[model samples]
Target: MMDSLEGEELCYPLLLNVSCRGLMRPRFEAILLYTLFSSITVLTVALNLMVIISISHFRQLHTPTNLLLLSLAVSDLLVGVVVMPVETVRFIETCWLLGDVMCALSYIIGFTLTSASVGNMVLISIDRFVAICYPLQYPNKITRSRIEVSVCLCWACSFLYNGLILKDHLRQPDRYNSCYGECMVVINYISGTVDLVFTFIGPCSIILILYIRVFIVAVSQARAMQSHITAAAARKVPVTAKKSERKAARTLGIVILVFLMSFCPYYYPSLAGQDISNDASSWAIVSWLLFFNSCLNPIIYAFFYPWFRKAIRFIVTLKILEQGSSQANIL
Candidate 1:
């Protein structure tokens, strides 16, 4: 019994030592990789937060899609704030130094936010498809109340789905630490597998299908509008309407492209059964790809919507001028 007690006492520190192994090396190449990843992660999260703050501070962005975007921004921000910092330190440490409780909490938060982000995207795609394909019906179909309901449902589903972690049967007599070093309890394999399938694989598949349908509808609508424009011109109809339709199509294309590019990198490895490793390069790349989603949201907005650029520019210039005036006053 004394030996067993001694063994239990050693487990915690031994785990820490194991987690920190090889982490202190200052290898230039490894540093470069992780540094690059960390920079991108920070940049992306920063952009996400900036956009969220800007929209909240100014009420002009209260549209349904923007509201959904806000939800996504919040989720991504949590990943950026709560998840990435710890993860990065673990990367540098080369181990899970924090223990089981932190590990469980991090995993739960990361997974939930990620689920919400992807889920919101899917909902947005569905919203866009309806707006583009059935403009007249869209107003009646997707009212503010409906949007709110959908958002609530999205969040509720996310919460309940992740809440299954409560049912996880794993007893961490040994403190849980993530591959990265945060102390958290690991869910047993069965629960973990179930959560992964339901949260990641299932929603991802649905999103993929929805986007595919959305693209098809968008392309068809674009072609139909073009033909209609040609006929309208033949009949001497106003050109402004046609111009608006063309612009909308282009914006949709850009949004779809950005979404695909940003998400594909993060999902591909997981779907492919690729091993995640402590190799600094792999961790760096994963970090970049994941946090990069947060950044791309605002960028996609700015690129696809002229109004977003105007909002961002106006906010940025106003801040700069305000800061300059404050400096002059101080001097």
Candidate 2:
């Protein structure tokens, strides 16, 4: 009876000696958690996929700003497709059945995509700052080729940076595993601090500074435009274009604010001088909160863009499949 009871708790009953113990949560609770996270994963993927399809299919949406948004959507999609399901299984099952290699790769991929997403946000801020601050130079400064190069560099740097951050874990995938079936990655306080600074503080600082400048310039421009635009000038289309740019800047501001809120809790341990561990008791809530940001980005950021609304209509109605849909007026 003792042997059978031990078997019930062990992840691998046959290899009892080295097998890790599993969670003792009731079956119903585990199922409920699984169902909930699965739904989130699906929603995140579906929403981000819509953004991708919308931007990619419509020629009018092929501007440099949308290209940055496209990069962000791709990263968020990977988070949903790769990171969310893996984490859900790791947390709910409390067993790392996929083995050591997968354990390492999963985190590497997750962190890289996350860093890339941050980089994309920074680029978006810079794009807006240029547009709002120097309207005449915006087109020349934020070109498609320049944004493309910047995006490629952002992703490449992310991969390299995260690889260094998780070098030890990648080198020895089972280094932190206490027993078989366990998956744990611990970032020592030193590494965690460095990560917090680069991944959170540094990038966020740049984004904050740029957006502040953008906001100041935007306000001045708004006031000037309002005072200077005569009824005859307002009747022309030029005034409307400037107003549209201001609206987009406001929308992206909300995206950055949500990004900060989602990220702050996950780094709280580091803030408190503790090493970051994936297996911590509080990890579930904070980590899922960060992942939940991926689901919210599309709704919060893209939903405000009128073109996205119109694109979704075309897509949902299958009108996007018709000939010359790629040339459709999305903006």
Best lDDT among the predictions, by candidate number: 2
Per residue, candidate 2 scores C-alpha lDDT tens digits across 215-318 of 67766666567667777777664666577567756765776678789899988888999989988888889888888888987887688789999999999999
Prediction RMSDs, each to the true structure: 7.9, 3.6
Query: What TM-score would each prediction reach against the true structure?
Result: 0.70, 0.90
Candidate no. 2 TM-score: 0.90
Best model per TM-score: 2
Model 1, 1-331: lDDT tens digits are 6654442322235555544223244578558857865786687677787668655655556678778777777877777787777767665554455655665566567667767877777777777777766889998888878888888888888877776764341245234333333343434445545655665566656656665666666556655665665653755433554565566556656655665665565445445555322242555565456656666766765346555565566567775245333222110
Question: What is the C-alpha local distance difference test score of candidate 2?
Answer: 0.87
Q: Name model 2 segments beyond 4 Å from true.
A: 1-8, 229-253
| C-alpha lDDT values of all predictions | 0.61, 0.87
Off by over 4 Å in 1: 1-23, 27-34, 165-193, 227-288, 319-331
Assess candidate 1 and give its TM-score to the true structure.
0.70
